[model samples]
Target: MSMRLARPGTSDKAETSPLAVRGLTVSYGGDPVVFSVDMTVAPGQMTAIVGPNGAGKSTLLKACLGIVKPLAGRITAWGKPVARQSSRIAYVPQRTSIDWDFPVTVIDVVLMGMYRDLGLLRRVRPQHREAAMACLDRVGMRDFADRQIGQLSGGQQQRVFLARALAQQADLFLLDEPFAGVDAATESAIIAVLKALRDEGRTIVAVHHDLSTVEAYFDRVFLINRRRIAEGPVSTAFTTDTLHEAYGGRLSDGFTARRA
Candidate 1:
């Protein structure tokens, strides 16, 4: 849990952070959702992007993945532009954003992660299928490999999507609301898998909503509210004062009562 939170480009080591954003700004039509935010994610640890609803946590994550263009800023993974490092990055978006009715089976969705390595012809060989199955097994979904995606419960679907990301074997994992709408058991299972990955020296940046679990689940925390609020180890940064600054009136009495 003892991790450093370096600013972007402050030193040679900082420049090599798993993910770095400098002066990022984004808007939909009129006003900006995120404005002039700077962030640095340390490698080999799980970092949570914590903020109130509609506070642009997801937008910031999307910008890192190049799913949305920034108004002004630079985003890099491993000291290079994200576009140049796509193969080393894997993203798992919010489950609510997916179309559960899609006709693809569990294994089919998992294999999609291998498309990058399959080349232009996109052939699915036996070895690729075996790899995909292994990924499903990692998330305890191998028994549902042949089932339609829509038939599974919300937690099951989340597990399958995570399996897809696992199949990619990327060094950095970006997830949006990973524990959203999931049961306690599923949440525990997912966190266990993510922790195992962090133990393997992989980096994880997740848009986490649960304040109670923030200190327990993440090594670091980035508190954001339209801009950078605080960034450091959860033990130091996940404080009542900082949480209030990021969540303001949205945060309940239970959080305000907790000690830093």
Candidate 2:
């Protein structure tokens, strides 16, 4: 199948952009990673960041959240700096980053999402626990709420983290490789929840690796290989050429021949 651009949904949605980045440049030890990239995320859509490994897709998300200091440029959510609107954004990190042996229960981890609203030194009320349990149910993990995190399988652990993100009820969700190392059941469950959230007008930006699923899973795409290659609707931007550029010599022919 040939690659083409999606209809121009991304062009006329400036008013709906909850997340906007301009002239963004990030570096580590004075070595540049992401170049000057300016992209606007339309509200209520799933935006996937796709590129070769080590191309800094995750770094771009971190820069948006002010977690990693950028040497240049700026990011804004809802026309305000992310630092000021942190409460409205939720992030689901890759499962590998989590410490399963930390002695936290499934529900306990989900409750962490509410601590921001609970405030410093404020006690977690019983209602907070109730809300967490509700989120666990949404992810099909309610039955595992009291279980030790380490005891769960890989997919179960992934679901637990997703439950935590859902409990946040944030307008914007930035997910890092939610599909990585997960079973098909877990992937199906997570995508179902994400689609439901999008139908509710919540914005989701995910760092995605599977090329074949891009068009099927996400509405928009951002292709990066240290520099932005394309940004727009999945059909329009996820072209063979863009993938080639982003992946460099790393893209497999099997994937290129397969259409999204």
Candidate 3:
């Protein structure tokens, strides 16, 4: 059996890609972070946003989610404006960006993903708890459901956030470096979950830093460096030349450096 997203609005029948950004530009303070980038992300596939440091990969994801106000261009989902379709999207941010000392338990963090559906005055039901626990089990963290987030390891914490995204129950998932600092086993679990979502026709857009695992994980690659390099299948777009150009002189990872 496959999972399906619950949509509340539509301007067009659900097609291949619901996430599209044209002429996107994001700036902070005075400087531009993402410069006029256009992207069309297709559903039912895992797309990896690969770039070097300061390349604004995270900013691009945020802009599409309407978290950062775009300085230019428009973002759309299902051929309508993003605001109308935001409820169908889920986002998982980097673990390092969060405060580890927060007093929330693992289940508490996962349940936050249901807030959009729960709204301000609603209360959690037994079904929601069951769903959240199922998500935790998918990421191999069900046993630690009651553990405080601050007490978990880096990999465990990352898995918890991913479980939170699953609880969002959205069609499109935007993940920021789910592989960073995770153990190999945790990485495998995350990839398996992402693939399961993709198999169910969900779209996954992730910011990935590991060059070695890119080919194994993503179905398509969007290589960027504040602008655009190339976007295609892993076999073509992730070539030596394109990677070198996008990374420039900053290829520090052992596998990536060897390729260079």
Best by lDDT: 1
- Which candidate number maximizes TM-score? 1
- Clash pairs, model 3 backbone: none
What TM-score, to 2 decimals, does candidate 1 have?
0.95
What TM-score, computed on C-alpha atoms, does each candidate reach?
Answer: 0.95, 0.92, 0.90
Better of 2 and 3 by lDDT: 2
Q: Evaluate all candidate structures by whole-model CA lDDT and list the values in order.
A: 0.90, 0.86, 0.85
lDDT of 2 by residue, 1-260 (tens): 14323323333343457788877999987668898877789799999999888888999998998889998986888877788888899999889987899998998899988878786888888989899999999989989988999999999999999889988889999999999999999999999999999999999999999888888899999988777888889887888888887787788888887753
Error of 3 at 175 (Å): 0.2
Segments of candidate 1 deviating more than 4 angstroms: 1-11
- Against the true structure, candidate 3 reaches a TM-score of 0.90
Q: Each candidate's root-mean-square deviation in Å?
A: 3.3, 3.4, 7.0
Please give the lDDT score at residue 95 for candidate 2.
Answer: 92
How does residue 124 of candidate 1 score in lDDT? 93
